[model samples]
Target: MAQESKPWYRSQTKVGVVLLAGSAILATVGGWLTGSISMANAVVALIAEVGALKLAFGIRDWPVINRNK
Candidate 1:
């Protein structure tokens, strides 16, 4: 699908990437400074968070038919 065809809010991949990057940095820095997570663990956590977000955003919303009802 073309980006121009999507709604304004739906076509926000750039914004999403920026938000994810910012959040990852904040989370890593906060946890590292507070001794909650080490630098290595912070890297792992960032990877997991990015993967989860990408998977979530990649899912397509399908319309379900009420055939059983």
Candidate 2:
């Protein structure tokens, strides 16, 4: 029997990478285009980055659903 491959969204590492990249772009754009960085914005960005990292590194084995085997 052939094994199935997991979807990209199911991979925590992939999700984390995308989240981190998005947060970085937001921070850079917010800082560069506005010429000002707010503490609130920085805090939010930090939270997102850290959360993504935590989710990626801290979790193993994705949750599965079953219908009576």
Candidate 3:
């Protein structure tokens, strides 16, 4: 039997979680400092956060995995 070492970049899950948490913190701080939460800003932030999470999680496209042989 043989074992292969995983690369550091393979820790997508951890990266995603960290990014998500950071996004949340940023959003909260922005809202607090501005004393107002703009819908547009919120939406943009949400989208960016989601995109980052997806990228961090190694999601490049739809379906998450290829089904075709």
Candidate 4:
């Protein structure tokens, strides 16, 4: 039996998680610095961090999306 090559994205997952965590921490701190961290602020931070990850790594497969169709 032969093993398949890992997808390119797997290599980037670690970096992505690190960046996501860093951004989340920064957001929390920024909110705390000004005042209390509201639920909406936390939600926005979560969404923005995920969006950043998607923009950075998810779009790498732009070609695959069209190719499979």
The top-ranked prediction according to lDDT is 4
Residue-wise lDDT of candidate 2 within 1-69, one digit each (tens)?
Answer: 954456657877787687776778677567856868776777776677767755664444243333321
Residues 1-69 of candidate 3 have per-residue lDDT tens digits of 843345534667655576676778587558856868776777777677766656654542324473431
**Model number with the top TM-score:** 3
**Per-residue C-alpha lDDT of model 4 across residues 1-69, encoded as one tens digit per residue:** 953445544766757665676778687768866778886777787677767656655564446664742
Candidate 1, residues 1-69, lDDT tens digits: the string is 633334324657745765776688788879988999998998888788767555644534212432322
- Tell me which of candidates 1 and 2 scores higher on TM-score: 1
Stretches of candidate 1 exceeding 4 Å from the true structure: 1-25, 59-69
User: What's each prediction's TM-score?
Assistant: 0.44, 0.43, 0.45, 0.42
Number of clashes in every candidate structure?
0, 0, 0, 0
Ranking by lDDT: 4, 1, 2, 3
Q: What lDDT score belongs to each candidate, Candidate 1 first?
A: 0.64, 0.63, 0.62, 0.65
Candidates 1 and 4 compared: the better one by lDDT is 4
Indicate the residue-level lDDT of 23 in model 4.
Answer: 73
Error of 1 at 1 (Å): 11
Worst 10 residues of 2 by lDDT: 60-69
Query: What's the residue-level lDDT of 39 in candidate 1?
Result: 83
Please give the lDDT score for candidate 3: 0.62
